[model samples]
Target: MAARSGRRRAIRGWLGKACTVIAAAVLVSSVGAAAAPAAPIHAPVLRAPAGGYEELWVPSSMGPIKIQVQWAARGGGAALYVLDGLRAPNDHSQWTSDTDALRQFANDNVTLVFPVGGRSSFYTDWYRSSSTNRQPITYKWETFLTRELPDFLAGYGVSRTNKAIVGASMGGNAALVLAAHHRDQFRFAGSFSGFVNPTFPMWNQAMRAAMWDEGQFNVDDMWGPAGDPAWSRNDATAQAERLRGLPMYVSSGNGMPGPPDLPYGAVNTVNAMALEAMTMTAAQIFRDRVAALGIGARIEIGNGTHTWPYWRQGLANARPMILDALGAH
Candidate 1:
C-alpha cells in the first residue's frame, strides 16, 4: 500500500515540473513577440509586361510607387537603376515608353530597375507639400529610392550592396547627387544631357522656367528661395570632388540636328536644340570639374541634340562601360 502511495506522489511531482516548464516557455514566447520588428511591407506584382518584365507596387514613405523590374537571367549581381527626364510621366519610365532598353537588356545578368513618376521633382525630397499645375504634389523620392526600395529588394535576393545608376536630363543630375550622397550604394554613375549645375547665377531661373514649362511648379518650394544651400548640395558640378574615385560617364550633344532630328518637319528639333544648348554648358562645366578632381571618366561630346535618339545612343554607348563596372559582362 505504501509503495503505491509513493509512486502516485512521484508522478504528481513530475507533472508539476512539466507544467512549470510549459509556463516559462509561454512567457518567453510572449516577450519575443512583443520585441520583434514590425512586419515588412508587402509588394504585390501588378502585371507582367511584354518582355518578361514584372511591374510591382512598392510601398514608400511618400506612397505606393510603381517600379518595373527586369530580373537578370542568372539572377545575381548588381542592379542598374535607370531614371527619367524632367517631364517624367506618371505611368511608366520613359526608358520603356521611348527607348528599347527593356529589349536590349532582357537577357543580361544584372537586374534593371526602372522607377516611374516624379515629374519635375528632380527625384529629391522636397521641403514641404506643394502644388504643380494646380495639382497637389508630395515628393519623398530620395528616401524611397535610397532607403525603402533597397530594403524591400533585399527580401527578393537582390543585392542592395552593389548598384549602378544612370539618368537623363533632370534624372542625370539626380543620379549624380544620389551617388555623391550615398557612395557606398552606387559605384557607377552616368549622366546624359543633364543640367549638372543649378547654383550658378541665372541657372536657378532657367530651372524654374523648365519646371514651369513642364508642370507649372513653383521653384521656390522645390529647394527654397534662390541661393539656398539645397541647390549647392544637389548640384552635380558642386559635388564633383566627392565622385573622384567612382567610375562615371558624362555625355551631351551640341544642340544640332542629328540623324533622327532630320526627319520630316521635326518640331521637337528646335526644342531639343535649345534644351541641349543649356544642358551642354552645364555638362561641360561638370566635365571640367570632374577632370580637375583627377577622376578618369568617359566624356562624350556627340553630334546630336536632346532627343530620345541621342539619349538612347548615349545609353547604348554607356552599356558596356556600365556592365564592366558592375562585373555583369
Candidate 2:
C-alpha cells in the first residue's frame, strides 16, 4: 500500500513536471568542435573472465569503450546489455564485475555485454538537440552504444533478438529511456536505485553537483533557475508511464531514517532526512502509477540505503526475474 501510494505521488509530481522537461531538456548544440577538446578516456584494466566471462572492448562512435563479455560456455542463448553506475571508476565497477552474475547465469547460456566508460553522459548523445536524446550537449555517448555496441556484440556471437538491457542508478534511467524510445533495441529493461527524474528538483540538484565537480553544471545550464522544461523529460518519473510493454524492474531503498555517515563524517543531516523522505515517497509514487499503466514490472523495497552492496543483493534477488523474462532455465 505504501509503495502504491508512493507511485501516485511520483506520477502527479512527474505529470506536473513534464511540461517543464519540454523546455529544460532543450537540445542546445553538440559539444561544438569549438569547445575544448574532450578529456582523454582511460582504458579499464582487463580482468580475467570467470568461466563464461570473456574480456574485450567494442568500438563505439564515442571511441573505444571497454567491455567485459561473458560468453555462453555451454551452447548458446540470449544476451544482456548491462549499464554501469555513476561512481564507476576505471579499476573496478559493477558492469565490469558482476561478481556472482556470471557464475549464476552461466547455465542460462546468455552473452553479457558489460560496457564501461560513460561517466555522466547517461549513455545519451548530446549535440544539443542530439539525434538520440535531443537534450544536453555534454557528450555523444548514446548514439555510440545503442547504434554501435549491439553490432559489435552480434559479430562476437551475442544473439541480437534475445537481448535485455539492465542498469542501476543513472544507468537505470538510461535503460528505461532507451528502451522506451527504442523498443526495437531491447526485449526487457531493468533499473535499480535509478535517478529516474531528470527534471525533479532533487535530480536537478544532483546534476548540479555532478557538473560542478566537472565544471559543467552551471546553475543556468542545468535548468535556467528551476522550473525548466527540458529537465522533466530527462527524468524517468516523467516518462515512466510511457513504457507500456517493456518488462522493467525498478527498485529503491526504503530510505531508512537516520543520520547517514559518509566516508568521512556527518556533514548532511538535513539532506539525508530529505532524501529518506523523498525516496520513500517516490517508491510509492512509482509503484501505483506504473501498475496502473499495465506495464510488466517488478518492484522491491526494504531496509537498505543507496549503495552497491544493497544493489548487488537486489540483483541476486531479482536474477530469477531476469531469467524469467529471458525464458531461460
Give lDDT tens digits, candidate 2, residues 116-234. Answer: 55554566654342232333344555676567776666655555567678776657777777777677767777777666656645556555554343223353432354565545555
lDDT of 1 by residue, 219-239 (tens): 778798887898888899899
Model 2 TM-score (2 dp): 0.70
Task: Note each model's CA RMSD in angstroms.
Answer: 23.4, 10.9
Q: How well does each candidate superpose onto the true structure, as a TM-score?
A: 0.83, 0.70
Q: Which runs of model 2 end up more than 4 angstroms from their true locations?
A: 1-52, 95-99, 128-138, 214-232, 257-280
Deviation (Å) of 31 in candidate 2: 35
Show the lowest summed lDDT stretch of 10 residues, model 1: 23-32
Provide the overall lDDT of each model, using Cα atoms, as 2-decimal numbers.
0.70, 0.53
TM-score attained by model 1 = 0.83
Quote the positional error of residue 108 for candidate 2 in Å.
Answer: 2.4
